[model samples]
Target: MTREAMAAFMFRMDGTSSYQAPKVSPFADVKPGDKFYREISWMHSQGLSTGTRQTSGKPLFQPKAALSREAMAAFMFRLEKPKAYQAPKVSVFSDMKPSDKFYREVSWMYASKLTTGYKAPNGSRSFGPKQSLTREAMAAFMYRLETTLRLK
Candidate 1:
């Protein structure tokens, strides 16, 4: 599933399905003519995603591109917007360090038991932040999220 689809599904699950606003759509690719236009626009408005391809001056959501683990963590973290965010001292995944872009979010995900990531053959765990998010993985994430929020 695309990031926009994930955002829209999450928004729907959060009980905020109403399209309320003078919608602000920054990406030219996701127009009103598109299928997930409103959902993508809403996600952007909520600050869950900044989209991709910004440095080129032509921002693109890359809607068809696979969503990364780090990006998913960031999305979940932003969606929650915890009352108090404290970064963990120790890293849960060997691949994720404190200096990584998704460090804090991944830390929160780990602390909350939202994800366990993938275990390597060497007995080390890797978050695989750059890997593509699969449908089953997204479902698992959403299940954990909804259960945690008691939204089910």
Candidate 2:
């Protein structure tokens, strides 16, 4: 199963835009009428894009792969907008070069205090937006969002 599919499943299950890490196997062979594919389609319908990280023109969800910061931030940004949530900080990463594609996303997550910065004693204060976002890190960020954004 792909990350997008799993995210879609979560979205459908809870009627919320957020995704929680699934505890069970989330993949199935690609085929028609499959629940997995249906969720992917559902996410697309909801405007959660399936990024162009595919092989042979097929989306590669790579369910086991860790979610990247870019991916997580993108998800949160799309999910948070309807709630009228404003990020707490403009940009949390001091080292994130302005030219990076995710500069704005990192800024939004930080401005809202919805993210964990990079390895810094001050609380991962310097987020490397390009770096991979880990499951643990994602959980922590969600916790922060629940508190700061008041969403759980």
Candidate 3:
């Protein structure tokens, strides 16, 4: 996907169906070499993200950094925590073993029907985790997440 496409994404919050502000733009043009590459602590302070990968205190927004399967799951799940959630028990993909930091997030996505399965890395599953998610997948996932929130 193109950077422009990623930049177009508008993060939405669940429950009341409001949009949670996104801190970073996937577009190269949108990211200036400044606070955009701050640490997860900054993301938390800004309510824009929940830093994973534990990269560094200075984890960049790297907007085009293709959304991984687990990453996407976590992203989707994170958007819907307006109330308490039990999350899901893993019983689907074997490739998704435990010990993965995103295990809980993956389960949440499955339980909520936000995701069916992980897309293959070779464009087989549409958009692989290593690849940036298309505008379509983002919308679908967010829509499902919002639906789950409403049901709660």
Candidate 1 accuracy as TM-score: 0.85
**Top-TM-score candidate index:** 1
Worst 10 residues of 3 by lDDT: 10-19
Worst 10 residues of 2 by lDDT: 20-29
| TM-score of each model, in listed order | 0.85, 0.60, 0.56
Residue 71 of model 1 has an lDDT of 88
TM-score of predicted structure 3: 0.56
lDDT of 3 by residue, 1-152 (tens): 43223223432232222333346632332343433222322334434454333333443445545656566666555545535655445446555545557677776676666777666665332213344566687778767755665567
On lDDT, the stronger of 2 and 3 is: 2
RMSD of 2: 6.7
Which digits, one per residue and each the tens of the lDDT, describe model 1 over residues 1-152? 67767766776766365775334457856766577777777777888877777766747887777788888999889888976878877787999889899899988887777888889998988888888788788889889877865453
Q: Count the backbone clashes (under 3 Å) in each candidate.
A: 0, 11, 0
**Which 10 successive residues of model 1 have the least lDDT summed?**
15-24
Deviating ranges (above 4 Å) for candidate 1 = 20-24, 53-58, 149-152
What is the Cα-based lDDT of residue 37 in candidate 3? 29
Whichever of 1 and 3 has more TM-score, that candidate is: 1
Local accuracy of candidate 2 as per-residue lDDT tens digits, 1-152: 23654465346543544543343322333344544555554454456645555455655445455556777777767656535544334445667655666566666787676765656776636765556765567667666766777653
